[model samples]
Target: MPTRAHGLRSRYRSLVVAAVAALMAVLLSPAGAQGAGSGGARTPLSEPVYSYSGAVRESVWVDTGLDGDGDGRDDRVAADIIRPREPARQGRKIPVIMDASPYYSCCGRGNESQLKTYDSDGRPVGFPLHYDNYFVPRGYAFVAVDLAGTNRSDGCVDVGGRSDVQSAKAVIDWLNGRARAYTTRTGGTRATAGWSNGRTGMIGKSWDGTIANGVAATGVRGLRTIVPISAISSWYDYYFAQGAPLYDGGPDWLSGYVDSPEALGRCAAVQQRLADGAPRTGDWTPLWTGRDYVKDARKVRASVFAVHGMQDLNVRTKHLGQWWDALAEQGVERKIWLSQTGHVDPFDFRRAEWADTLHRWFDHYLLGYDNGIDREPMADIERHPGQWSTDRVWPPRTTRTTALHPGSGTAPGVGALSLRPARPGAAETFTDDPAQSETEWAADLDRTTTAKAGFRTGRLTADLRLSGSSTVTVTATPTTSTAHLSAVLVDLGPDTIRDYGASGEGITTLTDRSCWGASTPGDSACYRDTAARTAAVDRTVISRGWADLGTYASPGKGRPLTPGRPVTLTLDLAATDHVVPAGHRLALIVAGTDRDLIDPPGSTPTLTLDLSRTTARLPLVGGTGAFVRATAGSTAADAVSMAPGARGVTPPHPAPRVPGDGRP
Candidate 1:
């Protein structure tokens, strides 16, 4: 009963079985001793083990679904890649570490002011920062992308809009084999990311990190995690603060600043859209919504390792605070590092610790390594310069809002900040003066000034630690339809602190260089070392807020008030975590027109505050009972003079550095 057809079928089955056995034998041999990474390549330690000098370096133009330049073609993003040449040639796939930035070409990056350089064949030779020098030699591929409309890319600058986000996301798609790319801008052959394992980690600072946040919000499949350092979550918060323009004509100018030279006359239309969409009246338009990534955090598939400076006045702390809160609400995996510096990258301030933690984070997430990062504390906070501590979470979960009311004091406008409310109809008044800054308004805490109204608590008997955002609710009557108000929470005491208001923004760059990873002729891992800039100060502004009375009702809508009519305006203070020592007193200064932080308003109006109605809700570690006990040993004299009343020197750096803040 053995038919010829049956014999042929049996022979075929035998051949298939033999082939599978041979394949399994080859896979399980001694040649497969590449460690136990489920994702292919493996990194055994926190240091680089693979070869960096022999890495394969190349460039590609990935196609994107954007017509930012309107040239009848899709915009192509420029990406420079560096990976281990031997492993990549041997058909070994690896995960990617990407940094997509607009600053790569125009302003440079990091402490050294480095820009990417290419060789004769248009292959990358010089890579900015230590990312390539460090990670490329650690079984990882480093990809530095020029955001659309910047550097060698083809497009118009859209700032944080669709073009900027989609272009970067398209590169991840290509790495995952879902999109197309080519060797050159015009054409050559198709460039395939065949050596990649479709896993990526994005890391950057400032606008570069912002792009990472934007891409992460898209829930991009290949993006495993993001390390956004001092990044913005919402573009609206960057240029406008609650319907108040932080400065005039922000969108268009920033777009043109980062755009390539080729985008000269071609991007006028895009620039016009930016200018037209962001109305001066500060209305929340469709343009800002497109740029707001915080609202879309629920769609994020990537774990976030957020690092922010509590004193980062440029991008501000609210961006990270709100973004982190949103991420937590979604129950996303997160870790945080809060520094006492300003607008600074941790690599420059806390180099060793940051590098080690970053290495472990990438290993755990992207490489499927069983590192104990999740078991470690969730927060690494630089409590003071050269001092760091860890916590289970940020803002310490024990935080509660303690409302402190302002009351009458014997020293004229110098009022008292206390748990008990002031008598009804006890009002204080001040005229808006654009000339006086927060520095001037906060000086001489016990003295009366026409420029501001001050309230201070008695000398604290115990340490009070504030760890979150604060809000000031002002119940006031304005003399005119247009009114601008400012509130500041100050730590009124002398303390040796890292001078965040110093010329270096709390970090001084030294000429002496330190190497992090292996160095090549063109690109080195060595950078100028930095140290903390310390200062002796009597008073330090802990947190501050500003409000345009026209937008009192809502942040999106601006409505003018009736002259002499009272309106309650609540504004958000910047987030913070500071410890007021046992002897220092906490003070709240209410003023008009914060000339140092915000642009001057058009009209100057005098405002009268109903002390009984106005109050500050602080995020103290413990509630009112804690505050009452801390300041229990209080007297009228202690209230009159804030503690640590030493001779204070004026810091060299006093206000926000505009053009300088955008760089580095």
Candidate 2:
């Protein structure tokens, strides 16, 4: 019987309100409507209540208790079949929705109560309900499964790869056999929809999302449309932003996989095991090429609707771009939505829209309804200030770029002067003190607050949106063979801010866009001095078949450079989509590193910038020419200074202080 817990429903209702309020404050504030009634109708927090008070007609659990791997670990697992509360008079073979999740199953009790609940008064009530609720009444059955290594399931945790695939096959086989004995409408046809980490859909948010992408790669029959919300295209890319690994989220994730308290107490055990597992050992190696979803995008025949949050710092918006690129390359028919909040936000403010989107997708694919989901734009877009646009393809045609120049003596505090290309007259120079501690465009890694001889650009009012790959082309004469130069795009709105670090790649802070590509790919011929060193390795094996492969070579030093010719450094900024609006002047500050942003070696130098010969090519939209004219000097100084309550720019958190360097 479904028992609607009024207490839980009330609490969840409050949560829905709170989530909307927070999202509105962040996203809908400038629209002049800051309250509940202003935005679109908020979706109800809970799903429609369903009753299971009458006879279940059919219910059974199959044993998944034995360890298939024969690793001496027995496991417990099972799935329950729930007949539709209402069946068609004329038997109809209805579709099935298989909800696969990593969450522990309370021996089928918890899973059943998720969709159908009752109040203390014995009245049915649904809380945190979803699309699956409408299925039963429409002659459909749902199978909720406990993935391997989860509650009552066997085998070690496989994060949605082979383990999930095998599990899905097992559950599907079981469901098909049981449906034959039932006289209800759902006793015939089948399909799947996974929520969260459920493996059924092979795609959706979090675990479910990744698995969907993986499952789709297999081209499983009967597997149709996959609606992955905020899913990761590549596990490596998800866990590690670029080369730097994501430390915080990964640990939280491991805890859930081994749900038991005792299993959790074995944290060190699991940690060690996983370290020896595939993820940690890979280290961005070529081996990951096997799991690269983008490479197999063409093989993914299932229709897909990938939804992502534009401001999702945790998941990072880069995944959306990566997926978009892959789908484009495959020429696959796909749908995408760029939501407004962070990862997995509640379905309140944009509830109707989200529900409508999902309903249409499932209806068209699963139920075979022609709901025009195909008629919509391929790419669902969102710009600033409630501007929601759509396009036949991603990275809309209007994604334009604008260049901001870095000039001499450009410190956080110093105002930029009107810059014009010099007649090749003089070259600016300054000593780079590696020990002095410097900051990148985004961090405080170095102790020094600012460096000497940097440059910046003035302000503008038009919102600047740059997508895809961006490069920083610079001409520099390094004093050392291995020199590191950083270029930062500072939001000179009202905050002198810097957002850096590997995690900082997808985040839109006051400023970002700093990278180091080989100055000339491999300009080894220019180097004059060189040195080499090597280390010996020793290995020993443990009784448990574990062996440490001893030490590998320590990082070696590259050839040093002689102090003569100036070379151009082409730095590849990670592909990002950010808009610096009109009123907010985009300043490009150049320095050794943003002490607050990057952690360079203790031996690199803090050098000066020569802006006289520097050039920038900014993509201007609806404007004439290939670039926007560089504006510096007094006009720039007045435009790009820090002020309070500045419009168009997200205010800096914790506030920013002027760097205590004399150059400014």
Candidate 3:
């Protein structure tokens, strides 16, 4: 044996050798060096490392700052949470993807009508829709919240008002440790979202999506992004169009429709406020201003991913159009998907593509992955059914407003639309009748005694694509103190169009079922298939606009017109992305009172239009050059003249009549 000192020196030398060897090995390996460094190599976001089957499911009641139910306690929003079990087991925090909705227990979501399913202990074993199943496995915590008064939450249903919005905002706050929540409604154990990372994203469709928009408008922290599909930007816009009530019963009826427990009388106070607040004259009030998200766009800090069906009549396209415009104005980072289907989710339309895109979006925003999604095109528009195109910007930056003039044709109640202005003093007249529906007024194109005036352009030499909102400038005088004006843009083509204006909003219930993700006994991941409701007709109404003539200058109040005094009314039709094919004529139909969309005036009024001053400005995407070149070669002498109510043009076929229910 060696001496004790010699043995110690030998052991120290051995230790030094092993340490040097280990350092060298680490320095030689790039991956090992990266792992050891302060700035570590990032894990690939595309990998599916999280297990969906091993997710932990739980519930919490978030406190909204109101006693909506008048129970002398704050309203609580019920949230069903599903997250990766590994995160909580390993003491790791995960970001949240939330869907706050009122349809969790009623009416369901999407075309298939999906409802939430719970286990025996009231804990959610299976969440409704595919959001929880698909995202939970992708390392995201999915929270499906039951809006106040819906599901098992405690509150009166306020529709899209303060209670509805605050219900969602409170959930987001609780996730970020800013709000109070409990394990039960009144006196249960306290709960904390300690497993959350305080970063969240909100998404949903229809009313669910509207909640996303409403919550984002509050600029709450922890909400990083939002995806609102077919959402409502303004409650007034949903039920009214330019100061004209679009639906009856206003907010009260809608509040009752979505509220559950079958006892709407429980929320009678809330419903009464909605009814009492809504002015029948369609004038804007504090109630509407409080619910208008577009007006509060500046408060939105979260990035937006907006989707809308061009033919969605239930929520209408204006909700997306105006909201998108406001977001752009605010310089909010945004992406858009405009589809051809009516009120349909992207998953139902383009399943695989939607899944991939949404996955990548979550990876980039929530996972902090450096994906190139933000660098891609800002807009994806469905040109036709099952066909999509990308653009650098929405509404095409190259779009120009082209004006088309109106003139009388050889037929009675028939007129001509031209690219040039009509002569001075040229005018047309129509009488307002409250009982007539738009379809009835448009039924006889050549009839002279109808309550509407029709003007059509000659057959197009080339295809005309309208990509944005069209404006109708009417110079008319009302015989009475007030009158309602309805402007319609018609596609005079004999083709099948999506009849979203009809009941059910063009959704056809089918017996066929399609599975999306994993299913449970309580919540099946399967959904029924649906087809577009269509109609074959001689003419298809592309878009329409309504205005309470008295509220022309301001939406809040009316300015009555003097009898026989011409006043210019500039109204904007719904935005569209449609191709008016060659040989099809575009028509402008101006009528009084669209009974299908709004409550009619109480009196009959004769309205006279000054055709010389009246014009329709269309947002032509690419065919403006062709139109200018085509019209440049012609003169004013080419204007067509027709008698009133002549029998030259065929009437449009009877179709669904709903206010602002025009095909995109």
Instruction: Give the number of the best model, judged by lDDT.
Output: 1
Cα-lDDT of candidate 2: 0.42
Candidates in order, TM-scores: namely 0.91, 0.58, 0.85
Selected candidate, larger TM-score, 1 vs 3: 1
Q: For model 1, what is the C-alpha lDDT against the true structure? A: 0.82
Write model 3 residue lDDT over 429-527, tens digit each, in one string: 999877665566555454566588888766665677788788899989889987888998876655555555554444455688877555556656677
Q: After TM-score superposition, what is the CA distance of residue 79 in candidate 1 from its true location, in Å?
A: 0.7
Least accurate 10 contiguous residues by lDDT in model 1: 26-35
lDDT (10s digit) by residue, model 1, range 265-347: 68999999999998777778999999999999999999999998887777788888889889988988999998888888999
Q: Between the candidate structures 1 and 2, which one is better when assessed by TM-score?
A: 1
Of the two candidates 1 and 3, the one with more favorable lDDT, higher being better, is 1
- Model 2 lDDT per residue over 427-542, tens place: 54544443322223222211224453433445554454554544455566665544445444444443221211122212222222221111112111111111111111110000
Stretches off by above 4 angstroms in model 2 are 1-89, 96-99, 104-129, 138-143, 164-203, 249-273, 277-282, 286-291, 346-349, 384-387, 398-457, 461-463, 468-579, 587-638, 641-664
What is the TM-score of candidate 1?
0.91
- lDDT ranking, best first: 1, 3, 2
- Listed per candidate, the RMSD to the true structure in angstroms reads 7.7, 18.2, 7.6
- In angstroms, the error of model 2 at 79 is 5.1
